[model samples]
Structure formats: structure tokens, C-alpha cells
Target: MPRLSGCAFFSDKIMQAKVDLLHTGAEAMFADLGHFSKKAIQIAFLSSIYPSLVLTYAGQTAYLINNVNDFSDGFYKFIPRPVYWPMFVIATLAAIVASQSLISATFSVIKQSVVLDYFPRVKVVHTSHQKEGEVYSPEINYILMVLCVGVILGFGGGKEIGNAFGVVVIMVMLITTIMLTLVMIIIWRTPPVFVGMFFIPFVIMEGSYVSAVFTKIPEGGWLPFAVSMILALIMFVWYYGRQRKIEYEMANKITMERLGQLLAMPEVQRVPGLCFFYSNIQDGLTPILGHYIKNMSSLHTVTIFVTLRYLLVSKVDQRERVLIKRLGPRGVYQCTVQYGYADNLSLKGGDDLVAQVMRCLKRHIAMSTDRRSSVSTEEEIANLEAASLAGVVHVRGKMRFYVGDDAGCFDKVMLRSYEFLHSICRSALPALGMPLQQRVEIGMLYKV
Candidate 1:
């Protein structure tokens, strides 16, 4: 009776382990969605991969049933001896391809998060000129390689590694299902009954898998949980710190009245050349502008406040990419360069940005209907041409954020972590293709 009970318990464990391993293959099927179209992936999986997987699993089960002693390493044991070497080579190649796919997917996810301000800025290299989504981040790739090595060394075997992988796979599936349900209800306006119908079965199945995996926590499942929590905390700190910095800039923005007063100061000199002041806010002058005026007491001949805005769409029309608006002061304009998530920043530093801005300025001046304004088309055009002849200077603010003296320890630690990340991550200006000689950075401190 005791032997029978022990056998039953082992059978149950084997079944659950198989369930955990099977889901990983399903997850891998969609991992390279960034590299291929959804329709192509779905069609391939449904027609070829799914049937192949089903047959392979069925054959393995049959072999195991017939040769119970070969249950250990059944995958290899079931293979015919004559073709074992070929099968092993094919499996090794497949594993490499899968790893590459997952790496590409990781880069795509990180790029999207950076665009949406959920992650710190990193150097992203577009692997394909035609496909914007095909990206490779060296920093992330190195980190992943290190972590993979460490995990392999620490776990020392497939069983413990499988425990960790199973937990992560189940959790990801559960989260994805919940997100899909929310999208169906909120975005697609699907009926509640339909949403529930689509969600409940998956949740129940995944919940069972989750329970099975939780039992492996002491073995190796805790690794994924720890790593995920650390990453989530870093992302949270970055998002929180970014929001606070934007709020501080908006609150301390220079008003039109104050700008006018500063411009009217006799000590202030209007220097020749086109100066582009980078700003976060679209409407008013950034605090960096105010700081520049207070220190140098000089303004550019043609000052353009440039703001880059990224939209959620895949691409924006080239005709509607740049929006130029005349601000209160003469020779001062605001140019908003809009880009979609999939659009490339093709405007290089020297003549490209200048030409685009000039074209946009000319269009804006010609389209203006305001009669009270002092914009003379010919004179403004001449001044801009002369400024272009002189040179273009890009002014960017180097900002540092710190917590207040009265802040709690959590705030201090979070802000400090954000600062450290910001220090190490790639700067926004360098990515713009701006030349170091022409770029000017004004240091500023903010108590967020």
C-alpha cells in the first residue's frame, strides 16, 4: 500500500513537470513577433509547428509507455541510433535560433519601454535599415549574457534551471492573459460575457500550472522572482523620477512676461547665429532658457526652442512631422519635431536639421494670418539665412534631480537609484547626431 501511494505521488509530479515544460514551447512561438508579422507566425504555427509538436509528444508518450525503463532521457532513447547524431545537431541549431529570437524580442520590448518613458534611455542599434522594429542593444545583450552564465553556473543542471524557467513562463502567460482581457473590454468594447468566456478557462489552467511551479520555489523558482522584482523596482524608480522632473520643469517654466522683461534688459545682447534650445515643455520657455539669459545676458539671432515628441502610432507623415510656431519675442520660435514609434531620426546635426527647420519656418511664415505680428517675411528669411551662414548651436540642459531634506528614505533611495541610472545611460543629445563642438550643456540642479 505504501509503495503504491509513493508511485502515485511520483506520477503526479511527473505530470505537473510535463505541463510546466510544455507551456515554454508555446511561449517561444510568439517570442519573435517583432521579427515577423503576426499573421505569418500564426499561419506557420497552426499549419506546421503545432502538428509537429503534437506528433512528437504523442510519439514520446507511446515510447515511454512501451519502454518504461527508458523514461529517463526518453527524448534521446526514443531516437533511432542511426539518426541520433543528425537529430542532435538539428536540435542544437534549433536551440540557437530560439535563443536569438528571444534576444531580439528583449531588445524590442526595451526599446518600446524607453519610448514610453518606462525605461532608461539606452543605445539602440537598428539591425535592419528597412525594419524599424529590428533592434539590438549591446548593453542589454551583455547583461543578458552575464545573467545567463550566472544562472547556468548557479543552477548547475537542467532540472533546477527548468524550475526557474517554468515559473517565469507561467507568470508571463498569466499577465499576458490579464492584459488581453483588459484590452478586449476597454479597447475593443467586447461584452463582459465574452471577455469572461475568453479569460476564465486560461486563468484556471494557468492557475493550476502556477500552483505546481510554486512548489519548486525552494529548488530554483525563486531566482526568476527575485530578478523580476529588481527590474520592476528599477523601472518604477525611473518612471517616477522622470515624471517629477517634468513636473518641476513645467512649474518653473519662464512666463511670457518674464521672457519679455529679460529680453528688454539693456545689458542683454542678441548674438548672431541660429540657436536651438532643447525643451521638454511645448508651450512656454524652459527653465534652462531663463538660466541661460541670467548668466550670459545674450540671446541668439534666431532662437528656436526644439521639442521632440514621440507618438504611439507606427509612423507619421513627413509633411506633418515638423510644427513651427512663433513665440512672443522676435527671432524666437518653437519647433516641435514629431515622430512615431517606428520612425527613424534621420535629421543629422549640421545642415539637415537646419534645412528642415528653415523649410518649416518659411511655411509657417507664409501660412500666418496674424496681421498684428511684426514678422516681415523677406527680412526674417534673410536673418535666418544669415544665421544659417554663421552657424547652428544646440543648447541642452544637463539636469540632476535630488530629494528634499525632509524626504523619507524611500524617496532618497529611489531618486539616488534613478540618478545612477541616468548617469550611466546614453544621453539624449548624442543620439541626435549633434557634433560635440557645436553642442553646449548648461548644468542645472533640481530638488524634485
Candidate 2:
């Protein structure tokens, strides 16, 4: 009786450790929510996936019970001899489809991370014209492929890989549970008792699995932990550096009055055409424009300070996409183009952007109450039309950031790493479809 009790305890622990790996599909489905509607995922899972999984697990358990002595490769061996090969082929295809879904979800997550300034910029290819969430990242795909190959080579067996996967999946579930609890309390405004009702059981269940899997860390579970730490460090450094850079820009930003004074200088020349100055700032003039004025001493007839901002929503209406505000200086306008995560600003051949800008300018002119007279509005519209005819010039900044002399060792290392990542990653120009000949890159270096 004592020996049977001990065996049962050992079997329970083994089952707890391996159960997370089985539920990995559930976590993966959540990750893929961006690619599909919430209703679609919920219905598919409840109606089809849940039933199928329950039946499959029941069949496997029954087979294991009948053949208790045959423990080695029980899953595959349980299948009937006639349909074994066909089932194997189907399982392989299903795995490939699941992998593809996970890959797509990864791309969507990375793109969101970039927008939120938590990661360095990377080339994101929108795979579908209509579905903005369907994206592919060549660089990330290659990185994932290399890492998968490395893991296969390092582990060299299914058991070890399964152990690592189980550890990571359980950790992810625990984190999700914690996040959901916070959301319930803070965002959903649920009562403490209700929150505890959902939280306590999950914490206890997942916490036990966490302890069970910790024993497997030395066996093969350390791989995911190491990889996760490295990625977290990268994200931390990128986010910190980006915040510092933004602070520096805000502190040194050129105001409209300062820009007006610069343009009024005797050496300054007002040339024909429209100049689109790209900036991260939404209101004030960018340091890049100040640099340009100081060096070239030239200004366009009509200048538009352009900033692209991504909102938290999935889509922004086309009618409300472009926002134009006239600045203190004549012919100076702030053009903000707003987009949502799942919104695409298709600037095919760059003509779409130019046309949109022209339309917004005309609308602003018509709506301005401060215009002295109808003649002034007409003159402004004519000037914009003439500038459009003269051609549009896109002025972009090529910026480099360096750490300050008084920075700590950690700050130096992080900033240096961020600089390296920035140097290699793709910029925003290519994605905008800006013409090469019309694009002008002004170089600026900042010590922050």
C-alpha cells in the first residue's frame, strides 16, 4: 500500500509537468487573435477544437489504460495499423499549419511593439491588401528558423525539447493569468471577491505546475529561459534609449517663433515648391528643419511639417486621416497623418500622399475663420496649387544618438546596443513609397 501511494504521487507530478505542453494550442490560439476575429476563434474552439481534443485525449487515455505495460511511444503505437500512416501524414500537415499561424501572430506582435516604441524598427511586409494584420517579417522569419535549427541540434531528442516547451508554455500561462487579474481589477473594475475567485484557483494550479517544471530546468528547460532573458534585455534597452531620445528632442525642439526668426534672416531664400519635413514631433518644428535652415539658408514657398502617428485602434477612417494646422508663420502647416494598427496608408508611387495633402490644404483654407478676406483664401489656394505643380520635396532626418559623458556604465552599454540596432534596421522612408530623387536626408547627431 505504501509503495502504490508513492508511485501515484510520482505519476501525478509527471502528469502536472507534461499537461502544459498539451494546452500549448490554447495559448497559441490567443496569440493568433490578431489574425482572426474574436468571435471566429471562440466559435471554432468551442464547437470543433474542444470536442476533438476531448475525444482524442479520452481515446489516448483508454489505450494507455489497456496497454499499461507498453509505455514507450504509446501515442503513435496506439493507432490502428490500417490508418496509422494516413493519420501521421495528417498530423504533420496540421503541425505545419499551426506553425504558420504562430509565425503570423509573431509578426503582428512585433509590429505592435515597434509602434509602441518597445522594439527597434524592422521591415514589415503586409501580406494582404485588405487584412492589415496579415504581415510577414523576413528578418524575424530567418531568426526563428535559425533558432529552431539550433534547438533541434542542441537537444537532439523529443523528450528534452518537450520539457523545454512545457516550461515556457506554463510560464506564459502564469504571466497571462497575472495580467488578466490586473485587467479585471483595474480596467474591468471587477470587485475584489470576483477577481479573487478567478485569480486564486488559476494561480494555485499554474503555480504548482511551475514548481513541477522547475525540476526539469537542468534537463532542457533552461533554453527558453535564456532566450527569453536575452529578448527582454533587448526590448528594455531599445525602449529606454527611445524614451531618452524623445526627451532630448522635446527639450531642444525649435518653436514656431524661433523658426519664423530663422526664416526671416537676410541670407534665407524662399524657393518655389512644397517641402514636406518629416518629424517625430506633432507640433513644434523638428531639429532637422533648424539644421537645414542654418546650413542651406533656404525655405520652400509652402512648408508642411509631416508626422505619422499610429493610434491604439484597429482602423482609422480615411476621411479623418489627415489633420492640418496652420502655424504662426505664413505658408507653414503641421500635417499629422493618423493610422491605426490595422490601417494601411497606401502611398503608391508617393502620389497618394501628395494628393491627400493638397486636398487637406484646400479644406483648411475653406474652413479658416481667421482669413482676412476671400481674396486671401483664394491666393492661398492658388499658391498651394502652384507649389504642387512645382513638385513636392520630402525632407527626412538621418539621426544618430550618442550617450552623454556623465552616463553610467549600464546606460552606455544600453545606448550603444540601441545605436547598433538602429544602424541596421529598416527606416520609415522605404515603407512610405517616397521617390528616391525627391527624398532628401538631412544628417543630425545628438549627444543625449
Candidate 3:
């Protein structure tokens, strides 16, 4: 949707309309309308109702030869071959471009959904050097190609394709209409009478179209339903399965007070430099950290507990980018990095993200050491430079899942699909834009 880019156009709607239409044939019509309200209604009618009426009339009067017949070959048969061939090439190119846009948009939504923890991840490779979100997915590209082939082979002709396309568009409209009605009551809290006035008729209109679309299922309409259902199942399984994993982690999570007490032990040696522990468990001690301590018997001089949190926003400002909370003593700190829906954590200048966290850590250390004193900007920058020179490393646990014999059918199915999809997705390490040598992965097993 152009909702993110249409702010200026919507802000000065009247001016926009004038510039687009005042010098054209609509200028005389606008003049005859006189007032803005009348002109607005006239423009809306011209754009929507008038066009539909004109199209219907044109189709009947110019193209239709009979009252009951609808044929896919009719239009091409009527047109001269010379004119038909030229127009066909042009339309084909336009359709190809339109299909490109649709596929890109779908992949964009899926990529963002993965970041938002609503879907399983896919391999997203940047195709554009200058644009942050210009990504290409091999998996999606091949899948779309196969589907396109299937569609071409399955459809009898343009009629079936048009039928399928119209059905999808109508179904989309119906879904949006229902969502708008809920938004009116839940988001805007609009009065029920007013909500009914705006939404009811539109919903009824779209619902009817959708009901009609359902009638075509026996005639090439079942493909979209099958595809959508399968995709929806995959998405639902990934989201709720991950949610269960998070719940499991939280249920067995070690509290901060206990973590601090463990760190305070005399035998816990502090090694030099920063060790970045990438974790999903935000507040508690992660199994990754527990496993590290159990094996190494020593801690880093500076421990950065990094948690990448994606916000519901499209883009976040640097001011609200990172939240650093110092947990008790022994160089332990939690650095929560916030990213927006459109943000690329692995893009160019990603080093600045880690540097920002380092700067925050330095500032926290200075403030805590002084008790009542504060860290100056100069001192913080100096500390960051120092820490950068010493060294920094990222540590993350790669979890392997298991369901016991007692697990029910639903649990087994969900977890099996979750692991299968998880294997295909790019793990957080490679997706994080960190140097390969600096990133360390430890294997972890979680039983459900």
C-alpha cells in the first residue's frame, strides 16, 4: 500500500486534484460544480460510479454481440491481428512489471513478519546497495515461478485467469471491510450507529461478491484457497510454536537476583574484554549463559547481554534505538536493541549499532562507579574507543528441539514443522551483521 508514502498527497487533496485535472477536460466540469463540496462529490462520482456505468455501457454497446454469451476469445477475435499483437506485447510487459511489484510486496511483508516473530524466517539477500529493504529471496522466487507455471497450465484461458483474479480481489475487499468495521469499534471507538452507517453497506456489498466468488470453486477457484490455507497453517504453527518456546524458557528462567549472587562468588574469574551474549530471554539468565558458565568457569571482564527487540513501528529514531540496563556488579549489563519493521539490522553501518551499545555500557559503568556523579560525553566516547581496541565477541546458543513420547499429536506435529522451517531460516548470528570470526555458536537442547 502507498499509505506510508501518500502523506503529502492526502494533506492537500484539493490542490492535488486541481493540478492533476484543472488543465484537462475536467476543468469545465469543476467550474460548473461551483463549490468545493459539490466538486468533491462530482469528482468522487466521476472516479468511481460514473466510470463503472460508462464501462458497463461501453462493454454492452461496443463489445457485446449477444446477451448470454461470455467467451475468452471474443475480444481478440474482433480485433485486427496487427493491432492485437502490438497491444498484446505492451499489456504483457505491464503485467510482468505488476507481478514483480506484487511478489516484492509479499516478500517484504513476510520478511517483516519474521522479524516481528509472527512467521518463520527466509533467506533475505540484499539486491540493492543503496536501498535498505531491497531484498531478494531465492526460496520465494522459485516458489512463485512454479506457481506461475501451474497457473498457466491449469487455466483454460483468460476467462479462468480473470475469474481467479477477480475472486481474490473480491475476497481481499471483504476481509478489509470486516477489519475496518472492527477498527471502528475497537480502535476509534466510533458509536455503533455511525459505524453501521459507514461500514454495513460496504461489508454487505463485498460479502456478496465473496459469496459469488465461492461459487466458482469447481471451476479453477480452489487453487488460491489451497495455497492460502497451507501458508496460513505454516505461519500459525511458527508463531504459536515459538511462543510456546518462549514460555518454556521463561518458566525455567533463572532470576536476576540469583544470577547476581552466582556472579558474586569468589571463584568466578573475570576474563578481559567484552563478550556479547545474544539471547531471546530479555530479563532472566538464558540457558546459553548458564551453559557458558558451567563449561568455562570464568566470565568476561565486560558482559553485554544483547537482546534484539523489533517494534511495531516502521522506522525508529536513534534516540529510542537502544535501552541499556545495568544489572548488579561484575560487569554484567543488559543491552536491548530496538529495530523497526523496515529496519535492516544486517545492513551497512550495522557496526554503529554495536558501537552505540558499547558507548552506553561505558556510560553506565562511569555513572555506577561514581555513585552520585555522572559520565561526560567525552569520557564515554573515550571508553568506547578503548573497548573497541581491546576486542569484542558475540555468543549465542543454537537450540535443538525435542518432544517426548508423552507429547500429544498436535504438539508433535507443531514442533516437527517448527524445526523443519527453522532449519531453512537464517539464524540470528548470520542475520545480525556481525563479523564471522567474532560470532560463536554453542549447541543447546530444549525438551518439550
Worst 10 residues of 1 by lDDT: 345-354
lDDT of 3 by residue, 147-247 (tens): 89889887857556655665566666677678988999999999999999988788765565566566666666677778889989989988877987887
- Which of 2 and 3 is the better model by TM-score? 2
Cα lDDT tens digits, model 2, 1-448, are 9999756645587767776677866766777776788999999899988998898888888899999976677789888899999999988997887878878888998887887778878877776656668788898999999998999998999889988888988998899899999999999999999999999999987898898898889989999899989989989988887887888788889998899799889999989999998898975777878888999999898999989887766677878889988887778889998877566565564448778878987999988986543358888999989987898899988878767789889888888888888888788544767777888999988777
- Return the lDDT, model 1, position 372: 38
TM-score of 2: 0.90
Candidate 3 Cα misplacement greater than 4 A, ranges = 1-60, 66-72, 80-82, 123-138, 154-159, 264-268, 311-320, 340-352, 368-391
**What lDDT is reached at residue 265 by model 3?**
72
What global local distance difference test value does model 3 have?
Answer: 0.68
TM-score of each: 0.91, 0.90, 0.75
- Give stretches of model 1 more than 4 Å off: 1-14, 128-132, 311-316, 340-351, 371-375
Error of 3 at 276 (Å): 0.5
Residue 199 CA displacement from its true place in model 3, Å? 4.3
lDDT of each: 0.83, 0.83, 0.68
* Count of clashes in candidate 3: 0
After TM-score superposition, the amount by which residue 16's alpha carbon in candidate 3 deviates from its true location, in angstroms, is: 37
**Model 1 lDDT per residue over 296-363, tens place:** 99999899999888765667787888898887888888899887656666447544655777888887
Could you arrange the candidates by lDDT from highest to lowest? 1, 2, 3
